[model samples]
Target chain A: MELIIDRLTKQYKNKIAVDRISLTLNKGVYGLLGANGSGKTTLMRMLCGVLKPTSGEVKFNGIDVSQEEYRDSLGYLPQDFGYYPEFTAYEFLLYMASLKGLAKQSAKDKAKELLELVSLSDSAKKKIKTYSGGMKQRLGIAQAILNNPKILILDEPTAGLDPKERVRFRNLISQLGTDRIILLSTHIVSDIENIAGMILIMKDGQIVHKGGLDEIIKAIDGRVFECTVDAGEAGKLISMHTITNFRQENDKTFLRLICDKSPCENAISVKATLEDLYLYYFKEVNTDEKLF
Target chain B: MDNNIKRKLKSVFEAPMPAKKDDFLNQLDYPKASRLDFIKSQAGYIRKQVWVLSLLLFIGTLILMYYFEVSDSVIWILSSALPFISLVSIGEIFRSITYNMDELEMSCKHNFLEISLIRFGILGLANLAVLISLLILLAGKTDFGFFRLGLYLTTPYLLNCYGSIFAVNRLKNREIVYVCGVVTASVSILNALFTTQINDIYTDKYWSFWIISFIILAVFSYKEILKLIKKMEELKWSLSLTV
Candidate 1:
């Protein structure tokens, strides 16, 4: 199902959390990349009907979200998900399934199946309090998918995961997104770099960029460059260029920086990445306002 | 036989249902599952409070029985008060931990209507329990007139109980409820101590004063409840818009 968010805004007293922003999402994995407090979480919460918007509407296939029916196909994992500490992983998933209106036998069956899918079947009987951070995240993912929801919203789904578990979780989400609209919100760009079918970048409560991965990369097509400089000069180079990475070896520094055109004598042109585009847009937007 | 069991287990794990995207949208329109969904969702928290309150009440009952060295009359009081106190305290504790609408919105199965009803029902039952205990005490004296007085007092108790739960849920905070519970408990104890005088006053022309007071309190409570419900509806609407 398609999820459409139109002119959504959330205001808390004098501060605006989400400005009037609109976007339409189709079935696929979409990365919602933004800095912290950039309204990414607010937008996600609004989509799941957890937080009320100051104005505007969120709809699934033209059905307004305020209707309880719209929430049935929606699943969300908030950044700070609270679970009953005394419940076993199995029990917790079962409880979530019931909330989603699954039949008793179906909920039990789905809980067991999802536990296996997230690779937590071995510890399914263990209380949630005893779980490690990565394990809890895996359980969160499991519960989010227990109802086989059509629209899945996960906020920082890989925040505390180890590298290996992070990769596995991403793969699982990638598989799930083939038939559902998956909006993965994170401050970490790399989490969605390879998997996202579309990337929407948010800044100051507005979507600054939205398109496919290659299209976003194309936004800064000839901006990235790499060069070797003396170790002492590397700091000076960063002031003039968008230095993405720096490696020091044998008293020389290899710097991967970004500029509209080549800036150094020995600089080699390189293809732009999602990270380069994100930093470039955000940096440009910030600089235009004369704010460091 | 073991091999057959193992095969069955493997088959259970391997089975997949082809991921039928059933219409969750339609199901949301279905009648909400049960009022117990709220209690069940808060079961873990309720169990803890029940355990602690039950233990304390049990010990207090034993000590009172031993110290008074009275007949079945004393046992009767202990038996009545023990369960009533334990149940009310447990209900209060559950209400305290589970009143946050944000948390309930996240964890429970019911919609806002069902959730409010469950909260009101629990608080109502607790208040009813206290009223019943007072009635039983009057019965212990074989005073039907006093029993009738206690029954009459239930009208105010029920009104206050509903008002408190409604107020707490609308604010989505439990501190107010805690303060009210303490105040009401203290007042009830004081009232019980002066029951005979209060009953005498009720029989005289002062009965009209109590009736008028009850009417004023009920009106004020009704107004407060309506305001709270309006605020909650607004809150829910604004929240939906943001999403």
Candidate 2:
């Protein structure tokens, strides 16, 4: 299903969490990349029908979300999900399924299937209170997919996961994006770099950039440069270029830096990445291109 | 030419399939499900209270039988406790229902005010208990009737206590009000029950006191109900904006 978000706005007292942003999302993986407090979570919450916006309309396939029919095709995983401490993993899933109107036998079968899908089948009978953070996140993912929703919104789904689990979750999301509109929001740039069909960069409640992964990288084209300088000269290079990140070897400093195309003695060209683009957009400087 | 034929063949095989009907059962109307869920959840709490009160009354009946050496029939006393127990259970059930409704609103999910009239049903049972107790006393069986009245009075007091505890736990902002209301109402009922001078007053005066006490209790409980209703309204507004 396609989702249309029209002129969405959410103001908290004097601060605007989302400022009249609008976008149309179709069946693909859309990555919302921003720093913390950039309104990404608030936007996702509005889309999920959890937090109301000051002014906006969210419609799925031309159906308003206030109608029950829209909810039938929607799934959401909030950033901080609460669960009944007294319920076992299986029981909790069953309860949620019951709320969704699934019959007892089918809910049971779906609960077991989801637990296996999230690799939590062994802990299905265990109380949720005893689960680790990663396990709880996996369970949250399982619940979001229970109904095979058409529009899925997941906020920071892989925040606390280990490297292996993170890879597994990303792969799962990639597979899910084939027939559904999956919107994944996170501050981690690398998480969405490889999978997002389009990347939306937000800052101060406004989308600063929207394009494919290669386009975002291309924004910083010819600006990324690497150079090895003696420790004494490193300080000068740092002041001249936007130092995105750096590595050091004995007696020399290697820097991944961004600067307009210009003569730099011994500086070599390197490919820009999503992280480099993120730093370019979020870094604070007096230059016109500096995001902050 | 070969590519065009291959594309045509792919289109023939890949035409969208016809839509399938939902295999799952249709969702029950939320209002209907909410009412049923409320009743089912209350049944558990009410059942527990009935068991406790029944046990207490059964023991009391046996003790009275032994002390008075009255063997006309023990069935009457047992049967008398039945209506009283049911009345008390009804109050417990009402409290349970209100508690769940409050919880549903606090979580900002659904509305339940339409079902709130259920509370008056419990209040009616309170009135019935008092009427039965008065009838027994008028029949000239002072001892049995007074004891039954005491049991009947305990129902409302305990229900108020349970309701206050539930309100305090569920609505954090109004805990003090709920607690004070429960304590004051229970104290008034207890005082009416034990005071000899109060008992000697006219029957109309006694009934008026009970009526006034309940009215005050209802008024206090209604404040919390209003708070719950306001919260539900806010949630609904929020849902609309977000959706």
Candidate 3:
């Protein structure tokens, strides 16, 4: 049940959307975190076999990505997908089930079961055009898993979800991750913060960091500093450091920032959080990585 | 809420039932859909507009047959619309890609081509049905007998097919394929008007030429369709690679 991506690279004319990247995964939930245009979608597309790589390949066990048997184990939800406006939610899932080679009666039962799982059973008979964005995204999630795929890939699956819906979606994903390989890509750091067993932080078309949350946070451990300064001094510190947070109390301002060397006399070192680690790794200017 | 509705609501928010989950995966008795099932489902999805248009074409044919004495010119004019119907039927097959379902369809185990071909066959049958009905309406009334009627009817329809299949491979926008169809139908009509074959069907002089031309166009159309399928898959995969 191992999925191996070997040196996958996609180039368009002079620009490289996804640079050479490789990874291997078994059954678990892995989060791909990156800013826009950072190649998360591109990599996920390659994994799902919707897009081919220019120089490398993805294999499920030993089977090629282009092979039908490999696809039989795959379920993918792209960043942008369309549904037939005329189709009822149940009908749409049935169509997708057929495309995946499911038996007709089983497909119908599966469609009913999935719509219920996604909490769309009440509206399964209604046309999709009448559904809201969150409902549609839930439907998207349901269809991606209708085949009971061994490998499920979702790109920005929470884009249109509300806060509560996002939480429900995360719980669903966390439960599914115990047996299957689930790879989800998103820029929302917190969306994956609680559920993902491992995180891959990407930047400039490459994975700059890959590890468990605590391990990655350890990289910036001694670098985060907390200090209180007056308005005039806070302005000076802001110019010279990457400020993660700041709030004014009394006449002084409390500031949290990342720096190799302390920016002020009273600044005390604090533990690094995932957000701080993210800012440290992907801020406008590249930072020194003396700590691994 | 009723007690039953309340229970259903509670179940929806709870974890998916374990029994249903196992049944979904372990149901080996579930038979895979045969080719006939695919064809049936494809036919089920055919657009309602196609049915409406087919009815209108039939009514139009009936009216024209009742009023005008069937002649080569009348047969030629009525047959012009057949090319457009053929174009529309093919357009229906391309509708999924137009609506952005191509990405999802291509990623499935069966892939896009299989579903597309099934839908194409269904629509192709609809197109055939309309053509045959038109021929039957003109069967006894027109001096243009079976062979000649078949030639006139097939020539333009085949030309439309050829033009559409050829354009689809080269053009990015699906609308351009319709433009190719318009050109094909126009040329066929103009040729039928001036060419002596339509007026002198009794003579065997041009029978061989028409049969030969029809065969050549049909072969070219089939090859173009194959090319269109290959080109579409290649382009999508290549575009994905570069994107």
How much lDDT does each candidate structure score? 0.67, 0.65, 0.81
Q: iRMS for model 2? A: 7.1
Candidate with better TM-score, 2 vs 3 = 3
Candidate 1: pairs in clash: A46-B243, A51-B239, A52-B238, A52-B239, A52-B240, A52-B242, A53-B239, A53-B241, A53-B242
Single out the weakest 10-residue window by summed lDDT for candidate 2 chain A.
Answer: A283-292
TM-score of 2: 0.69
Which regions of candidate 2 deviate over 4 angstroms?
Answer: A236-241, A285-292, B1-209, B236-243
Candidate 1 residue lDDT tens string, B160-183: 444454545454333565645654
TM-scores of all predicted structures: 0.76, 0.69, 0.84
Q: Give me the candidate number with maximum DockQ.
A: 3
Q: Give the poorly placed runs of model 1, Cα more than 4 Å off.
A: A284-292, B1-109, B122-130, B133-148, B151-217, B220-232, B235-243
> Clashes in candidate 2: how many?
0
* Cα lDDT tens digits for candidate 2, B1-243: 699998999988886765542322222222123446543332332334555665676567557756765422332344333445534543443342322223221211221232233333544454455445444533343443554454434435544544553454364331345344544455444444444334443244466665565566556656765665564434433432221
**Per-prediction DockQ scores?**
0.19, 0.10, 0.45
Better of 2 and 3 by lDDT: 3
Candidate 3 lDDT tens digits, A182-216: 99988788987987899999887788899999998
